[model samples]
Target chain A: MDLHVEGVKKVYGDGPTARLALDETSFTVESGQFISIVGPSGCGKSTLLMMMAGLLKPTAGGIRLGSTPISGPPPGVAVVFQDYGRSLFPWMTVGKNLSMAAAADKLPKAEVARRVDEALTAVDLAGTQALYPWQMSGGMQQRVAIARALVVEPTVMLMDEPLAAVDAQTRADLEDLVLALRDRYDMTVAMVTHDIDEAVYVADRVIVLAAHPGRLIADIPVDLGRRDQLTTKAEPEFVKRRAEVFTLVRRPAATSSAGSDAELDGRPSELKA
Target chain B: MPDPSGATSTLTSAPPPPPAGDKAPTTRVPRRKRPFGRRLVSGVSSLWLLVAIAILWQVVATLSPTLYFPPLSKIFVQFGQDWFTGDPSSLFLSQHFFDAALPSLRRLAQGWGLALVVGIPVGILLGRSAVAAAMYFPFIRFWLAEPKSAIIPVAVQIFGIADSMNVFLIFVGTVGLIIVNTADGVAGVDRMTLQTARSLRISPFTLYRRVLVPAAMPGILTGVRVSIGVALILMVISELYATTAGVGYEILLNQQSFKFLQMWSAFLLIGVISVLLNVVLELIEKRVLRWQRREGLSGQ
Candidate 1:
């Protein structure tokens, strides 16, 4: 199952008020790869991910899952929203959240139950089914959110800045948890994030996006294998790539539109890939 | 693990041990397991002020033979005589109880129940749509301003000396609270949650049942609780205006006859009903909103 965002553009309003959020963005996410869409605030990183998830419509062009054009949320695609506080139903127990996410497919009782248990187990939250989301720590709540996504048994999982809210330690732990779950499920995942270190750390490929009418500037392949918090980060190649993406991300956006276009288009030829 | 007295103590507080069959769990949720009996004892101890007031009222009313302020002893006697003259088969409830108190209770229940049934959906509609809110909100405000006293007499002209009139008046009195609160609650559900529901591909029906309604429940329940007082007030006033069989009518009747003891008893019954309803509502809220209270309690 492949995802293609072909010539996607987003405009917020009309006439004088119209603001271009994304411009002529095109990219393809191959099956089962973890891609991180990373950039600063006002960058359309989240906007791109939302379009890919079929939660938002592109003003022009289209997003497609396999051969089918994404008009609405396609089956077997799920989103893990960033704000854990605003994601899960506060009134529902953890198990209910997961099961309810799956209830849309109208799976048989046993099958829905199985998916619920399996999803929780994937996040190491199996025994926490009975607890309401608010009963858990912030980190635990995010895990529940991940489990909720997993319950859909998605072929593709789109996450929008999922770790932006948690503490440093929780963020690191969750980063690894997401990777482990990705490997275990063999699901294609696109995570939208702001941290350069995190974007390079977890992604199979880091898709660099620049702010102000966000568009892709560079697509770097990450070759590091079996990454961990310490040594993988310390590797020469890892440091080089991290520094490359960091510098590219940290470079000040041009004040003028013409200036930004020249500076922002790092590799326009590779963007449509 | 089902402890009938709402005891969580018997449920182990220990984190469900990380399963050996899988990777160890990372994030942990701390579960509190306080003894229910201890909680009950401590909770009961806080009612000393209420007891003190009751005792003081009894002593003061006994000493002063005021016409309006009858002694507690005499009021109790009147209550028993007016309410308990029925045979054992009828639970010893009197005919007067059936004529007044019971009718008041029934009208309150109907009007409030109808308002809830009508109000919640309308509230949800208003909450979900700015167009609906904009259209209906001012109308709701205007109607809310006109008190039950004006509503009952005017409405009686149309519905005419009927329980429906009383019920309709109560509904008019309380529906605004429910609608406003419910709309607020529904509107309060954040953007991400709605987005999550869409991403999960939740069907429209399931979205309302699982996401929209539950998310707005705290607001809905708050609205429900706020309206109880309004509903009670409207119930009595509705009876007072029209030809009716209710405690409001009886209170007027007893007052005109100068049966001050019975009037006091009627007022006492209203107080008891109000207290009982609040208590019942709190109990229901504790159960219905167990998730909400659980978080609040965990902080304590």
Candidate 2:
């Protein structure tokens, strides 16, 4: 189902102590689309993702999955957190952790087992079911985290910097793994990342946000024909898109207060002019 | 895009498939499975200092041979007479073994068992809920601070010199520590693990059972170990008051009658029993915490 973040705002505390974390952010992630929300640190990208997952409520407006407003964690939504060591239960074996999603849904024993095995296979961690997360490498543990999300057969998979902790090679491999899984399952994915090229490489469209009360800056579509770890990234069009996002990310003011100066100038030429 | 040059180097290399035998780092540290004879030899080697201490003790006692401090050999003889000597058909365990040692063992079990059964849930409740802890933690802390020995007379008054008084004293001595350690364990549960549980939308019951309890187990087991020691100490103390059948009572009876060697034998037996009980508990702890051993996270 499509996820709608309609005029969502999050302000922590009250009155003078109140700090705006996100300001009237609005976006609709079309069903089955691979969307990446990218920005600088403290851009509230994670906060927005958490709100979308219904783990956090927006201070104003609302988030809706299809027609349902998410007041609490909605069904058919799974989150893959950044810190796999913290996110995955160290006591449980990889299989047990993966199967937890299915078990939480109270699926039949046989069905849960089947889904666990299937999800592990999807993440290329087929035989690691019995191993603990810490026993494996960082990359492998993140795979277990992703496999955990897959077990639920979620309509939307929200990843919060899931590849941030791994090595560069491992990050690329996982990036491809997520893209492959998205294609195979036709999964709707809303990933929050800080890496510009990473956001451009995997996402069908990239939503860029500016920090200090995060607000949407650009909703640029990535149309470099097809994505590849090799040729697609080397393409001129990909470079142009990456530079565009970098410019938007670097110039915080233009995106920080959208259209105010544009209305005065009668043209928003400062960005993508 | 990282310099495509360096990034591409490892791009083609698939993560080495988990090794066939023990390639995974988690599987690398094998639990030591020493042969029985070797384990015994190692055990004996580890106890050499204690053996030396025993020899020194024997030498000192032999040289002095006071009425109160009799020779080790005489005490060993008394010990043999008290528990080891018996008819050939009774497996050489004397009547004193069944009377004195059995009751003591029974009381220890009852007291320690009650402590665990009561302490764990109360601990988890205190750890998880702020209101429950706010209401009860100070009370528990107060109880812990107060001398447990002072409660013996009160217990004797209520239970009237029965086994219940002995069991109650042991319970009083140990339960508070268990509750505290268990609460610490519950509080120490990694934040991310709780977040994972919340994300999964697990029920409150399973959240505690599958997630909270196991996470806090290592701490609870530590509490159990310390509580066992406390329980044994309280058992001996409680038995000294009005008990007639237990090890402590035997020591007091023998001492009052001026059978100093027999009293020493009871003391020796109590020491041996305490060591044996601790060993048993350690073995059980090792078995229960086998996974922790693999992670090298266990206290042992």
Candidate 3:
């Protein structure tokens, strides 16, 4: 399903105690597009993803899935959380976790089993049915989390820093794994990450969010023809895009409120689409 | 498959196969599958301290024999004579065994079982619902701190020294702690796990049954073990008053008659039974908490 984030705003409290978390942010994710929202720390990237997943509500404006505004988690939408250790149930086995998502969606028992099998196989974690998630390594547990999201055959997958917890070697494997799954399932994925290269390498478009009441600073398309961990990362276009994103991310915030607003709003209107 | 987005995104070679080494460490958790020789070695190592303690007890009793502290051999003889000699047809248990041991065991089981039945659900309610917790938490804590022994007189006045009185005492002694522990366990469920459940949109009933209860089990089981000790204490204390058929009564009867050896034997019997109760509870805990241990999270 295609997703549209209208001019949404989030403030934590009322009056003077209030802190702005997200500015009037707006973006659209076409169906089957891989979009990554990248930003510095405290940039409210996770807050934005949570809003799209319908787990958190925006204080102003709204989010819509294919013309219908969602007040709660819409049908055929699944989430992959960052803290896999806490996101997956510890007492349950890997297969049971997948089955849990299916069951919660109210799928029939036989169909639940079939989808669970297919999902695990899709993640290359077949025959890991009886293993508890805690029994597995960090990478394996995150794979279980991915399989859980896939088991529901979601139209939109919202991942919040999904690979931030794993080692570098395993993170590369998982990055490739996610790319493969996105292709196989044709899933429209919106991932939030702090890694600039990772955001550019995997996403069809990188949405750079500026911090301090996060607002969209740039939306650059990644047209690098091919993506491979070994070669694609070394491509000239890939390096150039990474440098551009890095510069935007590290750009100092103007002390004057008007200056900040002008900088964010001064982008070419065509890039907003 | 059709390219749904119309992007010519050809898949690269499939990701490398999942690592096999990930599954190797988990298979070693089935402790029972160890070779017989290794099992024997562990068993002997575990029991040596107990053996050393028993030997030390025997030597001390032999060196300083008193009327209250009879020799270990004499106490053993009394214990055997009192319990081991019996009617052959009735599992070789003596009449005295039926009078004292059976009644005590029955009371413990009934009281502890009732406490569990009453405590778990109430605890879950208190743990999960803010309104319920607010209403009952302070009241439960106050009652838990009040000793069960202090209420025995009131219970005796109501039930008049019957089996009901003993059961009431045991229930009062145990149920409070269980409820507290179970509530804490439920409240202690990981926040992210609960959020995952919410995002899945599972029913409230399924959430408690599948997620909350199992997650809180380790704490509940710890409460159960602790309650067993409490139940044992209340059992003896309640049996001390107007109770004709229990180990406590036997001990009192031997004391009045100046049969120090028999009194010591009764104390020994109670000690052995307490240890046995703990062993049984530990076994249940091991089975129930197999996941915690295997995950190497806690239980160490």
**First chain of model 1: TM-score?**
0.93
How do the predictions measure up, each by TM-score? 0.88, 0.88, 0.88
Model 2 C-alpha lDDT per residue in residues B102-192, reported as the tens digit of each score: 8998998998889889999899988888888899899999999999999988998999979988988888889999999999899899987
Instruction: Show where candidate 3 strays beyond 4 Å.
Output: A255-273, B1-13, B16-53, B56-65, B86-91, B294-300
Each candidate's DockQ: 0.36, 0.28, 0.33
Q: Is candidate 2 or candidate 3 better by DockQ?
A: 3
What interface RMSD do all candidates show, one decimal each? 9.2, 7.9, 6.8
Shift of residue B251 alpha carbon in model 1, Å: 1.3
lDDT of 1 by residue, A136-206 (tens): 66777887899899887889999999999887877886887788778777899999999989998899899
Candidate 1 docks with a DockQ of 0.36
True-vs-predicted CA distance for residue B274, candidate 2, Å: 2.1
Kindly state the fnat score of candidate 2.
0.25
Model 3 DockQ vs. reference: 0.33
Candidate 3 collision pairs: none
Tens-place lDDT digits, model 3, residues A1-273? 689999887777666556677777888999999999998886789999999988999988899999999898777889999999889987888878889897767878899998987777666666677877767778778888999999889888999999999888888878888888887888999999999989999999999887776778888999876467889998888999999999888886443132336544323232111
